[model samples]
Target: MFVAAIVGLLVSMLFALVRAFLGPTIYDTILSVNVFGTKTVLLIAVFGFLMGRPDFLDIALVYALINFVGVVAVARLAQSLLRDKVAMLIACVCDSQWDC
Candidate 1:
């Protein structure tokens, strides 16, 4: 049963990877990456149990934290860039009307 579950998780991870690569929007790609990260954590936990090494769960937890922080950072960066672009466009549009 564990083997089957592991295989299923692996398959889902593969699909997530594919979506991450082919997603049309930034949010879609980010969401796929997050899914992939979560699947990885699950895989690590299950594989650790299969190997009789409980420490692997700790490692998985750390990896999960890293993944969460990374995704947040990427999202914030993307949002800031988008906000800046919108601000610049507004400024440009208003400048032409002497609105400062």
Candidate 2:
């Protein structure tokens, strides 16, 4: 059963990887990557449990937290950059229409 769980996780990870690569938008790819990261954490935890190392679960928890925080940070950074680009485009349009 544990082996089956690991295999399922690996298969899901593969699917996530495919989605990330084929995503139509940056956000979709980022989401897929986040899902892949989560599966990786689960895989680690399961493997640790199979090996009888509870300490590895602690590592997995840390990895999961880092992955979540990293994804949020990247998403926020992308949003800000996109916003800045849109703001610049608006400014350019305004400048062309008026003396601002």
Candidate 3:
């Protein structure tokens, strides 16, 4: 059963890779990448368990936290970029004297 879980995780990782490569938007790509990261963490944890190494779980936990933070950072950056674009458009419209 463990082996099957590993195989399933590997397949999911491959699918995530495809999504990351073919995503139409930056957000989609970022989300795919995040999913890939999560799969990696799971893989590591499973391998550690197979090897009877208890310390590996700690590493996996750290990796999961880091992955979450990375995803959040990417999302924040995209949001900021969108806000900047909207602000620029508003400024351009307001500065035009034709409306005054």
Candidate 4:
């Protein structure tokens, strides 16, 4: 059963990677990458259990936390960039009209 779960995770991870590579939008790609990270954490936990090493769970937990943080940071950065671009466009329009 554990082996089967591992295999399923691997397949899902592959699909996520494909989506990340082929996604039309930046958000879709970021989501796919986040899914990949989540699957990796799950895989590590399962492997640790199968190997009778409880210590692996601790590492997996730490990795999961870091992955979550990284994903959130990327999302925030993307949002900031989008806002900046919008502001720049608005500024361009205003400047053309001699408004500033």
> How would you encode candidate 1's per-residue C-alpha lDDT over 1-100 as one tens digit per residue?
7788899999999999999999998888989989999999999999998888989999899989999899989889889989999999999989988964
Model 2 agreement with the true structure over 29-96: per-residue lDDT tens digits: 98999999999999999998878887888888998999989988998999999999999999999999
Runs in model 2 deviating more than 4 A are 92-100
**Candidate 1 wrongly placed segments (more than 4 Å):** 89-100
User: Which runs in model 4 stand beyond 4 Å of their true positions?
Assistant: 92-100
Count of residue pairs whose backbone atoms collide, per candidate: 0, 0, 0, 0
**Tens-digit lDDT string for candidate 3 (1-100):** 7788899999999999999999998878988999999999999999888788979999999999999899889989999999999999998888895676
Highest lDDT, which number?
Answer: 4
Q: Local distance difference test, per candidate?
A: 0.92, 0.91, 0.92, 0.93
Model 1 score (lDDT): 0.92
Considering summed lDDT, which 10 consecutive residues are worst modelled in model 1? 91-100
Clashing pairs in 1: none
Each model's TM-score? 0.82, 0.83, 0.84, 0.85
Ranking by TM-score: 4, 3, 2, 1
TM-score of 2: 0.83
Score candidate 1 by TM-score against the native.
0.82
